[model samples]
Target: PNLLPEQVTGTRIVSQGRRESDYNLIGLTDPRGNKYYWIGPQHEGELLRHDDTDYHAIGDGAVSVTPLHVDLTHEGALKSLREAFG
Candidate 1:
C-alpha cells in the first residue's frame, strides 16, 4: 500500500506504559472526574503544567495519532456469552 504524506511525516513514539500516572500529562483527571486530552496534538508549553492538576495532555501535536487500548473483555464477556447462548 502507498503511504500517505501525513502518515510518513509524523513523529515516532515509544510507549512507556498505559497507566495514567505513568505519564502525568498523557492521561489526566479533572475535578469532575472526567478525562480530557489530545490524542495527537499537545502543546509543548503545557507539558510543564501536568503536575499542577490531574488534567493531562498527551500526544505531542504532531502529524500522527496513537491509540491507547484498555481491555474491556472481562466486563463484556458476560454480555457476549449471553448473546451467544441465544
Candidate 2:
C-alpha cells in the first residue's frame, strides 16, 4: 500500500513476530516526495492453503509484483473533523 507524504511518517504494522511498533518500510521518493510502502500479498490462512497460492509463489523463490494505489484521506476522522468545524 502506498501512502501520501503526510501519512507515511507514523505508519505501524502489528502482526505475528513483528511487534506493534513504527515501521519505516518506505521504498523510495519521487520528484514530488510521495512515499511508497510495499505491502506483500494479502491472504487468509495460518498455514499455506490452496487459496493462498499467490503468497506461496513468493515462498518458492519466485519474484512477485503487486501494484497498489495511495489513499490519503482518513475517512472516519475526516468526517468527524468536518462535523466539528462546520
Candidate 3:
C-alpha cells in the first residue's frame, strides 16, 4: 500500500508542548477505497487524549492503527481496590 500503516496509542493535534486538541476530523473514502479528509470546522470533535502517541503515525501520508482492548478495566487497580474494600 502507498500509505504505510503505523500503530499509535492515540492521536492528537498540538501546537507546542501545549496540546491544541486531540485528533479530530474524519476522512472520506472514494469508490476505490482511497481515504481523504477535508479541512473544515464541522469535522472537528473531542475524540482522543492519549499521551505517548506520535502524530506521525497518522499524519498526512501515513496510516494509523490504534489497537484497543475489549476489556477496559485496569487489572492491577481492580485487584488492589478489591483487596482494600472487600
Which residue runs of candidate 1 sit more than 4 Å off their true CA positions?
1-10, 18-66, 79-86
Poorest stretch of ten by lDDT in candidate 1: 49-58
Stronger candidate by lDDT (1 vs 3): 3
TM-score of 1: 0.20
| Winner by TM-score between candidate 3 and candidate 1 | 3
**Per-residue alpha-carbon lDDT of model 3 for 43-86, expressed as tens digits?**
34443434434344444343344454488899999999999999
Q: Using lDDT, give the best candidate's number.
A: 3
Score candidate 2 by lDDT: 0.47
**Cα RMSD, model 3:** 11.9
Worst 10 residues of 2 by lDDT: 11-20
Per-residue lDDT tens digits for candidate 1, residues 1-86, read 13555544444343322232233346777999999874543433333333222122223323333355786677688889889996
Candidate No. with top TM-score: 2
- Which clashing pairs does model 1 show? 25-57, 28-56, 41-61, 42-61
TM-score for each of the candidates: 0.20, 0.30, 0.24
- Arrange candidates by lDDT, descending: 3, 2, 1
lDDT of 2 at 31: 78
How does residue 40 of candidate 3 score in lDDT? 57
